[model samples]
Target: MKQSSEASYPISFRKREATTLGDHLRHHNSVVIIGMKRVGISNFLRFFLHHQEVPTTYIRNGAQLLTVIVDLNDLVEREIYPFWVLLLKRIVDTLEQSKVPGELKKAGQRLFTESIQLKDLFFTVDCVQKLLGQLIDHGFYPTVFLLRFDRLSEVITPEFFGNLQRLKDAAQQRLSFIFTSFRPLYELRPDVFSKSSLSVFSRDLYMTPALATDMTTILNTLQSRYNLNLPKAVVENLVSLSGGHVQYLHLALLVAKKLRKQPETREELLELLLKDEEIVLQSEELFASLTKVEQEVILKHHRGLPFSQELQEKGRYLWETGMISSGKKEIIFSPLFENYLHRIDTPVHGGTEFTKKEHLLFSFLKTHEGILCEREDIVSAVWPETAEMGISDWAIDRLVARVRGKLKAQKSSYGITTVITRGYKLVRTS
Candidate 1:
């Protein structure tokens, strides 16, 4: 069923004044953008463009703008000419489609019409440069081309990669490229990418599920924009449950709002939420994206079986998807999905088994079992550097206590022990 009103919950892109992924991409000259292939990077870019009310977004002291998103999925892959043709078409369309001032709009339309008349003119690299130069002539200054390459590995040949570098050089930093890929670029091909090509894409930006740094701002915007009456606690818990995944968080809230009665508990909330068809379909899609090896890794982690260190990237990806979370010691699937995974009476392993922070703490303790880890060391390892100031000794103690309780609840033999004048140690009980 359709969960919520689109107007109520807009695409959840970052606000203008705030530093967003868009802003970061815009301000920086070089960016090799990596994101979950499924999480809709294109959608966010579109939303940002729409929010700016134009194709151009102001950056660096109210100067410079642009985000031209080309979904490679919509275009034929492994071909250069067709890709360029389609790309030029998209840029022209965006300029025509955008609500830019009259001159820019006319310029865009003119580019579109001229390019169409020229037909195969943009088939060559120089021709493509000429086309973009025309846009510059028309005043589309400092435009950032956001190319959404579905399976970048498939499209990116050594020749194609070099071509992209040439395009960047041709545009003279006026054109910055943001390419998306499912797996890491290095994993795709180390040899094909020349040093010059690598240098252009040297600044790698890993796109996580959502911008965790902007969660507070996002939550605040949601509450105000939607006029939601959710208690601060409820809102905070929603953040926790969603793991700051933008879409999942949006879906969860929509489901929460759809419930006939207000949910007094998290279980009640989940029950209401899991009923949404969209949620289930999205969850299935997430699982489907995993390879057998990836699936095994998740299943093993769920069952408390060991996963390889080599799969850290995969694990991190899964965690970003909100399907699983990492504890300091283990990876855990989301309880909502974990419960669904185990219908019969077999015990599910680590999920909701520990908070993310606690998991980090426990993971550290587990790794350092029998060694006394000072509070300072623990804080440094588990918490973000920015958060170190707020995390006091008492805060660490409380977190350790929570970990101890969770361990006991799981009937696990592992526990933490405080050492006088030292720190703490992870111990196993018979």
Candidate 2:
């Protein structure tokens, strides 16, 4: 079933974030927007471009505006030629498709037509440079939003980024650019990037938010989608239950549709939420989205285990990005997500139990299932902080014994063996 109107409206719930993005645009600062996967970065960019409230925000310092959005996805190829051409096309499309002054519009169309006929890289990029200059001449600042620009990580070369940077510099910095990516530009292989091109993005806007950041907008979406009209008490419980996650919000509405006449208890609501298969499946997928090390750290956190320094650093990132909750009782935020972590290690059929440590070790070993996990490798995975402090052979053997004992105690097909002079390997038993 269709969950909600989110696809059509797409972050119609994101007023505050929209405002933040607007402020960056106002300053003519080239900005880099960092957001996590499924944080709705793409849709937010889409909504920002055509959003009714956005146009009024474009005015600043008594100046007018021209904005163009060139989605990297719109480019048919990763080559520079196609990228520049697509950017030119979107700019020209903006001129033709928007309500710009007729004089500037006519000039842009004429320039774009000539550039396209040339079918040349230098000419196409030059057309873009000229268009921005024209907008400036006409008392307008040109802002370009490059959506999914991370795709250009490989497409970026010393020459391409260098030339683009020079174009912006040549425009007296009146030209603004906003690039959206799941990671920071430095993390995206800056080796090939020209330093000059990269430095103009002096502003970093993290679009990831606290659970409550857009809470009201979320409630409004659900309330309208399911025709919900509720008391303040119920709204409070729903807020606590949804944990600011949209999937949970959508399912909460579905559950509300079924049981609104019944009750408003938090326990009753959470029990119902955890029972839904969609919730569990989505939670599992979200868990899968994290890197393996992250998976282990978050899982250990949910179980209240001590973290190595590296995991602590990773945990900080996960928390800052809203993947986990704040403070001592840290959670994965969504109640459904919490449920997945709980059921992940314990077996379904024979009902074998693995302690959290045993589970993490087994998971790591299983990740390299059928391969050797040397003692040093084991120390790093199972004891990251003191791997350098040195673990004794008995410490390793005892944990292996405990894990091996549990596997056999449950009469499972999975088994492990010491590699005599080396380490241990997980294996299949007949």
Candidate 3:
């Protein structure tokens, strides 16, 4: 993040993200970038490679950058051997295409050819390691970018990642990688990450909102293609509706094309937005991309209600992703979205939706339903990450009261029974 912002603030949203990757590469660190669905990270990486932001701007210490991009989306075999083969091939391509000395190119070609002939994963990795070492020795810092690197973590064994970590460690961390995936690293592979160095992340870039220039570029392109006028006011409402999501922002225009001829006010546009099937689906999808805690924070904040500082910390993701703007008052950026949130949260019975804290308390109590849930245990469950912060008794009682009220309102089969001193337990109602 320091690297991304150290330079002047970027006018292009993805450039800001790209700048962060460049900074990490300069420091010899690896980064895994994730974005929400339909955010078009593929195009973003394509932009990075074409622009040469790293080679042209970063890398000032008399070292050139060696970039090998392997778009994993093209992988068909789903086997480790094929994966390694594809990666080595790309490194060879990068070496051949980039302006490196003939000796280095020859060395890379030799290893690549040998890896192809050997048919062994370790051998292929060894070949890659040898070339990376050669590049560094020749005043080049190598960075391998794995695009659409979504499923590799699921398919590849832990050994493959261990090898990758070793490769980086051997480089003294000079070797860096950039991975673009649909899901963030935290959600991508939490299982294998538990016992691996991949968990030691330096930075994670979420799908960012389109900058002002980006929105203008899209609108201009659309105006010329469709031969329809893009009104300033209508466009403002579209940005609000789409929350800076480029594809959906463009889609919003096409969806509302019929209503564009008239001077529809923002409220009128929102009304149409709620009824349009396509727009409704788009809004619901954007909402669904958020986690439960994220959902609660946004809903509370959207309604001008106060959100806890801890929960607000979670909500920072919303601003980073461009789902909301933090001006004088935080804006949800889409009125139609409020309606969607309300509809989904409508209680199946009398049970209203629980906020993040309430949900935490209820989940713990229900998990220990028949047994006594000690106060200490509840603290661990509800605030496991911040138990050292020391929640007050009043705060705990307030949380419990809220959960009890929700359970009673829903007429759930379960109820909370407080023990005299130690704890609480769930009891069945008649």
Candidate 4:
């Protein structure tokens, strides 16, 4: 049984902080909440808006709002000009239809009639100001919740900033602005907003649960909401595999429920998950995007080994690109994605034909528990003289070294053990 977002993390478990939802509402006019997708940012928003008594208007797409602002500016520039006497009449007509208060409607008219410079009229900086002032005069001055501000950073021009500043300056003391972004504000537009201004942005309050807590919560919710009886051991295994990522856990449970022939059994769940072709295809597509070197490195690691120094460097680059992550001594896909990768066949090394290096390595390791062969023997067995010299004994050694590094990095209990005088031996510590 899968739990809904609300049931997964109880409100009581939420973090108590100086900058909590209630605290932010009390102190500031706006508060931004930024987080990874499915990390509960939206859930928190729902909870705050419903439970905190704050009048919150969520602007899901800042880009869309900016587009509207720009279109309005264009309309104003092209339509209302030269005839300054007629401008106020047109502005009043626009505001009357905009549902603004009578007082604000009159103020907008006055501002329009004034000999405002074209530069100031269409300035991006002043746009926000005019909009906010209009909203306030219309009695909409509580708080402006700007979600996904990263999208706006792309379209926000100097003129937009000028208009925004005017709004900010005109806003009442209680009017506060909150902006949410997936990335840091500096990452979006460092030049436009200062570090001091960015500092006012609140960090996302993560609702991450401990492994045990997550497992317990998921099981409880599943049992209560879906009337599904899940075994404690199965729940434990699922949580362990999921790394406490709520989305993965929920997906895993949903998969198990869909294949409901002994959903309580770990082996049954594993079989269903492994045979999921859609999951495998998605995983393959992700792996395919990686560089040849990175794919080779990861495949090697998946086959219970690491890559050479060159390949390791390539793998590191992939990690930085969010394609992979390094654990203790092993290279792994991100935790949320590790299970998906494990379901697919390990890809082969590049420049080498469809040679059975993975099969040979696995078979060799299985057959020779304590036995070690000379370096020459590895080259002869894994790759004959017909094979390219680039993948010769030295190259094989580098591959073995990479495999060893990965094993050590992963801190695997069972790993390939190097034999100084001979070659290598697969040791099963467990």
Best TM-score among the predictions, by candidate number: 2
Return the top candidate by lDDT: 2
Q: Positional deviation of 127 in candidate 1, in angstroms?
A: 4.4
Q: Give one digit per residue, the lDDT tens place, for model 3 in 205-315.
A: 676665656555555556665677767888777766665565556556766676636446877776666666444545656676688988888888766778888888876
**Per-residue lDDT of 251 in model 1:** 62
Q: Regarding lDDT, does 1 or 3 come out ahead?
A: 3
lDDT of each: 0.58, 0.69, 0.68, 0.48
Using all chains and alpha carbons, the TM-scores for the candidates as numbered come to: 0.58, 0.64, 0.62, 0.45
Error of 4 at 324 (Å): 12
As for lDDT, the candidate ahead, 1 or 4, is 1
* Full ranking by lDDT: 2, 3, 1, 4
lDDT of 3 at 415: 88
TM-score of 3: 0.62
Assess the local accuracy of residue 237 in candidate 2 as a C-alpha lDDT between 0 and 100: 72
Clash number for each model: 4, 0, 1, 26
Q: Report model 4's TM-score to 2 decimal places.
A: 0.45
Looking at model 4, which ten-residue stretch has the lowest summed lDDT?
64-73
How far out, in Å, is residue 311 in model 3? 5.3
